[model samples]
Target: MIKFLLIVNRQGQLRLRKYFEEKVVTHGEQREIIRQCLSAVDKQNFLVEFKDFTVVYKKYGNLYFIAGITSNENELAVLELMHHMVETLDKYFDRVSEIDILYSLDRVHMVIDEMVVNGYILETSQPRILVPLQLLDVARK
Candidate 1:
């Protein structure tokens, strides 16, 4: 399958964005892996135009939230492939415990869940987490 990824170079300047025609030998591997990738980049309660961390997946686009010299752009490859999501995440690399961490879908999801729970929110989807908005609202109440 032709998968694309967005990766930020060592310079932290939205420099890398490319279409990777990665071939998956195993059946359904691409779908599953993509799900995982999205999961890694996932963060719940990331509202658009909020001037904070976010990650979004469109039909074939990306929207970067953290827009500055010190943005968490390690997912440059993922951002290039899909709509860049999440911004203002520099603290991930600034904090003592978060600095040494690697950004992945699972990690993102966990952090997002924690934040939402901390903020007293019921739950949130990754803009494209499979769960429909209508359902989410029902669950929220």
Candidate 2:
């Protein structure tokens, strides 16, 4: 199972976070975990295994899209899901950036909700994820 999803910038600050499971640590500890994870990787894609969970992350532009999952979960699958999430965000925002995600936080969360439920991947197709968001955008106008 997945533990959490996080979007952190190069500055080591979190842009967005979603937790699927129970809290196993305090806010500070969580921050520490993120910090450690970020520090551990220098590449665009990586999987870091911790004591209790594993981190799968991919870098996009200036932000790091990271997901935490149980050790038993498929790392490659989680990584692909993370890429899909980014692509969905890209489609929604035209061009994805930290500022775009910040401004469209609610919409971004909507995409996240559509893609992941209870830490499991709900959809993989871009069109499946984009249709609802497009409808929502049209309705908002």
User: What is the TM-score of each predicted model, taking all chains together?
Assistant: 0.20, 0.91
Report the poorest 10 consecutive residues by lDDT, candidate 2.
Answer: 36-45
Candidate 1 C-alpha error for residue 63, in Å = 10
Give the per-residue lDDT of model 1 (tens digit) for 28-131: 53233234334444454222221232233332123222211112433343333233123212233233122222343344443334323322323333444323
lDDT of 2 at 40: 70
Off by over 4 Å in 2: 41-45
| Model 2 agreement with the true structure over 1-141: per-residue lDDT tens digits | 888888999888889988888875568867876787678746654877665778788877888888888877999998888888888888778879999988888888888888889988888888888898889879989
Best-fitting candidate, scored by TM-score = 2
For each candidate, the alpha-carbon lDDT, in order, equals: 0.31, 0.83
Please list the residue runs of candidate 1 whose C-alpha ends up more than 4 Å from where it truly belongs after superposition.
1-85, 94-109, 116-141
Model 1 residue 93 distance off true place after TM-score fit, in angstroms: 1.7
* Model 1 Cα RMSD, 1 decimal: 15.9
List, in order, the clash count of every candidate structure.
29, 0
